[model samples]
Target: MIKQGLLVRAAVPACVLTGGAVAGGVSPIAWATGLVFGLALVLLTGWGLQRTGRGEFGPADWITFARATLVGCAAELIADGGHPHAWLVGLIAVALLLDGVDGQVARRTGTSSEFGARFDMEVDAFLILLMCVQVAETAGLWVLAIGLMRYAFVAASWAMPWLTAPLYPSMARKTVAAVQGVVLVVAVAGILPVLWTVAAVVLALASLVWSFGRDVVWLARTRVPAARPSAIVAITRRRAAPHHGPTWPAHNQAA
Candidate 1:
């Protein structure tokens, strides 16, 4: 029933976006891409909810869902394959602004959970990636690094599980992550000169690299070492040792 509700809720936006695209005379390919994105979003969200044993979407999850829908529309615009339209920029801006909002909603509504946080983060990452694809057309391919960095880290975590360890909260990390979206939006908006846009993207990428590098280093440093057989045996012995009074000085020892 919950999944059925989710599908019903998701279909509204999907249809609206598709209808808008078609009405605006967007290419079939672009609207089709939006549908594909919407479908994937629903499937993934449902899978995540099932994995986390969540039966209903929280208030913040709904906000994130709205943001995801906007992103899907933006993807359609970006897929149209030209300079971003004013509407595209507006959609992304709203999505980015809502990024902060969902968290606040989650916290205030007491619906915050691991699943919600991960869901928000993935949406943010995807929006950044979608913008990168748009900006890269003009800003150069290097701009892609800013978007792909998080994904690369995720892929690396598969090989080095330590990379998946939770990171301590840092304002700098959050600020850098936020900057990527803002900068990409500006770049895609074409508000700045070509050179300036490229430069802004470069700085965003650098900050992202620094933030991720710091996290990687911290994860590496804090990772628990796997115990060897000898180490395990020694630890077990220490744990199993019987407690006794402290040893007396040699002079006081019994003969």
Candidate 2:
């Protein structure tokens, strides 16, 4: 079953790349970049799945894989950057819409896993980054910071291992993550007046700053020094054990 999911993952990017090239007749280089990006996502995700213990791709995973394909296609369109078509915007809109559906499907289907949740988040981040790049031409380079902040945080983790600490989930973090994609897509699509677009983007960035700032402070306060791999494993195991709390009725619960 996992193999089937992997095959579907492979096919999606191939079809997207070929279809985009033939349909748009745009820059081959940009198409190639999108293909590479899509393939890389699939490969990286395969590794993540391995880390999740063992399970085949569930319905939610397939849906997210499809969403990731749309993100890759949108990235290609943004790379060429001639004019943003309604269709490219439409594609992104669908991807954003699907974000909500996957979680519900995961919970309903009882197949949620650490890998699935992380997969969804990484997809969200990449989409925001792609859209940020798309909007930067009109909104200015500062807009790129919205997308780059997550990557920046990851890089900072290298110098401060404390930054690598897992945060207790917050609704604020999820809300900010969702908002980043929406405002950036609006900004990229040029759907509003310049003033409104700028305002929305600014608001999005502010929320992001607040969200990340909160996480950083939390991680810093909670971080413990890891002197050994065994210590790290113990920390992870402790974190992974279930908490006593009310559980939701569904296939799986969203964090």
- Provide the clash count, candidate 1: 0
50-74 per-residue lDDT for model 1 (tens digits): 8999987899988998898888888
Q: What is the C-alpha RMSD of each candidate to the true structure, in Å?
A: 10.2, 7.4
Residue pairs with clashing backbones, model 1: none
Each prediction's TM-score versus the true structure: 0.84, 0.82
Q: Number of clashing residue pairs in every model?
A: 0, 3
Question: What is the per-residue lDDT of model 2 for residues 1-255, given as tens digits with 9 covering 90 to 100?
Answer: 777878877887888866765555568866787778877977888888788775467889888988988887777777775644786788789999999789999999998888889899899888888888877878899999998999999999999997765555467788888788778777877879998999999999999999888777755654645444454455445556787853323322222
Instruction: Give the least accurate 10-residue stretch of model 2, judged by summed lDDT.
Output: 246-255
